[model samples]
Target chain A: DVKVTQSSRYLVKRTGEKVFLECVQDMDHENMFWYRQDPGLGLRLIYFSYDVKMKEKGDIPEGYSVSREKKERFSLILESASTNQTSMYLCASSLQGALDTQYFGPGTRLTVL
Target chain B: TQLLEQSPQFLSIQEGENLTVYCNSSSVFSSLQWYRQEPGEGPVLLVTVVTGGEVKKLKRLTFQFGDARKDSSLHITAAQPGDTGLYLCAGPSNTGKLIFGQGTTLQVKP
Candidate 1:
């Protein structure tokens, strides 16, 4: 089984605070992604990286940014946390070629106070 | 924008019953994927269908891609308690990103 590990299972933060979420994959996959899952909106893509230091915006990338300084680690940053940002965040990684299947981490549930 | 719409947002049936979930889209896709997610966990990919009109089976679960590449379906024969989860369908986006459906939540009672 492929393992994608997220640093935090649950998190809480105050409004206007800067928050960071970390993810690591052991499989050395070339593709990494960050997404926020909501009740009716499903999973909206925030950002994705194809390689280290390479990033692209997804459908909903207004308030988020991503970093991939290392091959195995990907980080998501929130410039300013707000109440509406409270949701489950997921991290996923995939192989480099031919759009291989993506493996996902457990997810981090964030609560902005 | 291209979109994948999943039908039957919620379903509950007996353990022995069978059910089918639909994933429909108006635009053609190069490939389609099905995933099952448990509460508080990320989605696990079940199958990926690339050929139009392709059919793949895994134990009691079956997946079929539409002939036009615009739709797909998942049919579970004789579901069990372990079949309970959120079913999601996704397709490749123009920028190599993935677009996921709203998902179908299934509950199988024993």
Candidate 2:
């Protein structure tokens, strides 16, 4: 079975603090993604990595950056967390195909106070 | 930009009731996927439709892709409380990234 695990299931951070969300997949997928889900807004892509050291900005990438130093790990970094950055962050991974199934982690609910 | 629009943002039904959710798009897609998300969990892939005018069934759930490959629908028969969750539809963009709909939150009461 494919397993995607996040570093944290919940997090609390103060404003202007640096935050990091980590995701690891055991399926050896080549594609990984980060997204923030909000009520009525659905899942909006923040960043994605197709390969090691390769990254692309999604629809809403502001204030966020990604690192893919290895194939199994992807990290999302917030330069300086703000209250508006509080959201449920999800990480997903898929095989190297446009139509492949994306397996997602349980998600991390970040609270920026 | 490729976009997926899901209809009926919310639905509340009793057990044994039938319901359908629709996902529409103006842009053509090579494939579409449906996902079900329970509270506090990430969305899980339920089904994927590739060919136009295709229908697939999984237990009591049925999925249909439009002939134009621009739309899809999910229908549930005799929904139960276990079926309560958020249903999402997604399609791949030209960049290989997925564009997701807002989702339909279905609440089934026992």
Candidate 3:
């Protein structure tokens, strides 16, 4: 079984604070992704990384950024947290394939109060 | 744009009942996958269908991919309380990024 570990399960931050969500995968997958899941809207992609020092913006990457300094770890950054940014964040990784299955982390539920 | 659209955004049923969820799309995909997610947890992969007109079964669950590879369905027989969760369908987008449908949340009461 593959393991995708996230740094936090629940988080709360004040407005204007910087937030970081860390993820590590032990599956040696080449693709990593960040998505925010909300009611009615479902999961929307925020950012993704295919390799070290590589990042691509997803459908919704306006106020978020991603870092992949190493192959096994990817991090999501919220430059300035806001009330609307409060939602569940998910991280996933997949092997090098166009149709490969993505393994997901436990997810981080962030609340900006 | 989301490539897949799931039906019945929410479903609640009694244990031992059967239900079906559908994932429909206009564009063809190389493959599609189903995932089940519990509260406070990430979505977990349940099954993957690659070929058009393919059908895969996992115990009491049956999965079918449309002949055009643009749709799919999952039928659960003899459902249990443990089957309650958010069921999601995902496929690869044109840009290589994965696209997800508005998942169907199922709640089964015993």
TM-score per candidate, chains pooled: 0.97, 0.97, 0.95
In the range A3-111, model 2's lDDT, one tens digit per residue, is: 9999999999999999999999999999999999998989999999889999999999999999999999999999999999999999999997535898999999999
For residue B33, give model 2's deviation from the true position in Å.
0.4
Model 2 chain B, poorest ten-residue lDDT window? Answer: B90-99
CA shift of B54, model 3, Å: 1.2
Instruction: Rank by TM-score, highest first.
Output: 2, 1, 3
Stretches of candidate 1 off by over 4 Å are none
lDDT of 1 by residue, A1-110 (tens): 77999999999999999999999999978899998999767789898888999988878898888899998999999999989999999999999732578899999999
List model 3 lDDT by residue over B1-110, tens digit each. Answer: 54789999999999999999999999998889999998778998899999999999999899999999999999999999999999999898888777889999999999
**Residue-wise C-alpha lDDT for candidate 2, range B1-110, written one tens digit per residue:** 78899989999999999999999999999999999999988999999999999999999999999999999999999999999999999999988778899999999999
DockQ of 2: 0.77
Q: Distance (Å) between predicted and true CA of B37, model 1?
A: 0.5
Candidate 3, residue B98: CA error in Å? 1.2
lDDT head-to-head 1 vs 2, winner: 2
The TM-score of candidate 1 is 0.97
Query: DockQ (Cα-based) per candidate?
Result: 0.67, 0.77, 0.70
- Per model, the share of native interface contacts recovered reads 0.65, 0.74, 0.67
| lDDT tens digits by residue: candidate 3, A1-108 | 999999999999999999999999998999999999998777899988888999988899998998999999999999999999999999999897435778889999
Task: Compute the lDDT for candidate 2.
Answer: 0.95
